[model samples]
Target: MKILIVGPSWVGDMVMSQSLYKRLLELHPNVLIDVLAPAWCKPILERMPEVNQAIEMPLGHGQFSLSQRWMLGKSLRDNHYDHAYILPNSAKSALIPLFAKVPKRTGWKGEMRYGLLNDLRPNRKIFQFMVERYVALAHSKSTMLSEVTIDDIPNPALNVDNENQLACLQRFNISPDLPIVGLCPGAEFGPAKRWPEQHYAYIAKQLITEGHQVCLFGGPKDKSVTEKIVKALSEHQKSMCFDLAGETSLVDAVDLLAACHTVFSNDSGLMHVAAAVNANIVAIYGSSSPMYTPPLSQKVRVVDTDINCRPCFKRECPLGHLKCLNELMPAKVLDAYRDLNRNQNLE
Candidate 1:
């Protein structure tokens, strides 16, 4: 069997969608799976062993150029894909599969995509976790959705590039002599999802004091956020802290993250990437809830405040106060890290 998957746009969602690819390979051992995703996702898709190829999407996210979609889809006809799994819920996302004339096209129901998707799953929310929803599509439409458990959805495990990992460590002058603590304090969603910079700086300082080196990680948009955290740290702490937020590429960041002893992050892309790499993770949740999208890693600690208005899932806080994140003190995160460390030692 041959398959074509229209992958998710966001880094985290793209990473999580690996579960679906993995499930497909298990069901059909010899199946060839190719993913159609944004150029940004190429670095991530390359890490997945199940993917046969990573085809770049010409049209940008939210771009609805009918001519472009038709041409791109027409171009794929020669590949003779037997099936296509559209991960995004939008009607536009399903166009390529239809235009390509794939025998079967599957996806969750959303936004006037009735004719676009042939094997539509009506209730995506039935599967609580995003990974569950993706993996469920791999099963036949005749199968009951409720029968699929969390265990059925495989955790995404990205293959580390050891050569690139070494090059990044040398380029950044990061030594493995001290235990490395990676801090991912950026959330692409918005301010509501982000933990305070001061809190992150406090954590970095405390970890450094305990003889661990800290590496700040994020995309270019998050450079300011990481800079603020660095600014709050003392010169001595600054020397011990390496702010590589905007410095490293996504692929390079993944390599470096795999080398960390532990990773502390907000509910963001890097958090999911850290989990995929099998790093010890301290995931801090604010506007988002872990119940919906927890880290898939076994070695993970989820830190969140029990606030009434939290999990609002808003870009910015609807209310003036951001108690969900603000009230979540740095000490609480450190405590969670300690607890996770203890559990690992016990095991």
Candidate 2:
């Protein structure tokens, strides 16, 4: 069997999509799987052993260039894909599969994509986790997963490149002699999801005091906030801290994260990446809920607010108080951090 998947845009979502690809391979050992995703996500897909190819999408997000989609779809027709799984909910996401005239196109009822998908699922709420939803698409629409819970599904695990990791450390002039603590303080979503810079700086300083080297990780967009956190630290802490939020490529960040002893982050893509890399993680949740998309790691401590008005899931806090993340308290995160370290030591 051959399968083609239209992948999600965000880093976390792309990482989670591995579960579906894994399931497909498990069910059909000889099946060839290809993912149609953004160019930036190709490196991530390349890491997954189940994926045969990672085809880059030419058009930008929210771009409705019909000619481009049609041309790409035409280019793929000779591959003769047996099935296509559309991961995104947008109508445009299904266009490529339909244009390719794949035998079966599967997806949830998204927007006005009535004719776009042939194997339509009436609802997505049936599955709790996004991983489950993606994995479900691998099966027949009338069928259900043999293992009902998410625990039965495989978690995303990216293989490390040791040489590249060493090269990355050298490029950043960072020595791994001290225990590493990775802090991912940026969320591409918005400020509502980011913990305060001061809070992160506090954690970084405390970790450094305990003799741990701190590294701030994120995309280029996170450079400013990471700088803010580093700036708030004392000179000694700054010396021990490496701000590589915008410096390293996503591929480099993967290997770098695998080298960390522990990581702290607001609910973001890197948080999931850290979890996948087997980092002892302290995941902070502000406007987002952990129940839906908690880090897929056994050693994670998920911290969230108990306030009723929280988890509004908005990009920015509408009420403007921003108490959800602000009131979450840096001390609480420190406690989790310490507890994780203790547990790991015990093991």
Candidates' C-alpha lDDT = 0.92, 0.90
Q: Name the regions of candidate 1 deviating beyond 4 angstroms.
A: 144-147
For each of the candidates, give the backbone clash count.
0, 0
Q: Tens digits of per-residue lDDT for model 2 on 41-71? A: 9989888888999999988889999999999
CA RMSD of all predictions = 0.9, 1.1
Point out where model 2 deviates above 4 Å. Answer: none
Q: Per-residue alpha-carbon lDDT of model 1 for 98-216, expressed as tens digits?
A: 99999899999999999998898898998788888889999987784755678757899999999999999889989867789999999999999999999998999899998888999
lDDT for model 2: 0.90
